[model samples]
Target: MKAWQHLQREPGSAVADPDVLQVINACAPRPSPTLMRINGRVVIAYSRTRAFIDRDAWEALPSDGLLLLRVWPRGTSSSWFALTRPELERTFDEVRKTRSWNSVRHYHFRVFPAALEAFRVCMTRDEAPFASQISAAEAGSESEKRGSPVSPSH
Candidate 1:
């Protein structure tokens, strides 16, 4: 599923191209994680296979707010997950602590295929961590807008 498509469906959310953030690395543009704002919170939306996830690029996202990852496994439907900055940091810290790198500069964080399901519950559950963080009024409104738990946009 396209990452921003979900955000676009949210009544009060604003979805914009990654260029809006103008994030670049060493003169080259980083990968996609369309910028979005929902319920007055910023969210970086990523839609890609595990292998394409760029730790450096993601780490560059705003220190506050969530990273919305739509990790699609090979030949399978995508799953939606929202990670707070702290949660993302912890995962990155583990990679650094363990030195789990494919090479000198490439490391595989725990947010890979094996851990995708664990993250899915972060945003797709009834009391979704991310959703619950919203105010009661917003929660009720959003729940009404989205009658079911956030599911993969297949």
Candidate 2:
């Protein structure tokens, strides 16, 4: 919800999705790209429940739009990542070549903390400035200072 609000505040920005209400109200974790945005360029936004991404979601990604990934662990602060279409496709190809499908027949692309260094525009990096300073537990304090959009109790 904060991501959506932040995006909408940008000039020339517009966002939409048929399932936004469902996504927002969902009680369980789900694959994402919950909304689409046009801010000089089109972007598909996904607020992920974990650092890992499913192959089904990757394959379903649209070729024409950029991806805005929000990695938010439950009860923790979130980080933002802006992935280009080519990068998203390239990563999927790389994952397919080196990783095997699980029993469910889908590849799992996991982005553990160290791997986050490879992504562009990760908000956590911006906030911490140094990897040593990066801590999810501490993120809440920063969010509070910045006036978190979500209620404190949430």
Model 2 misplaced regions, further than 4 Å: 1-30, 60-64, 97-113, 120-154
Q: Estimate each model's TM-score.
A: 0.45, 0.45
After superposition on all CA atoms, what RMSD does each candidate show versus the true structure? 14.1, 13.3
Worst 10 residues of 1 by lDDT: 144-153
Candidate 1 lDDT, 87-124, residue by residue in tens:
55543444544344334333433333332233443221
Residue 40 lDDT (model 1): 59
Model 2 per-residue lDDT tens digits across residues 39-65: 343444555766554444455445665
Q: For residue 96, what is the lDDT in candidate 1? A: 43
Best by lDDT: 1
Each prediction's whole-model lDDT (CA): 0.41, 0.40
* Shift in Å, residue 124, candidate 2: 9.5
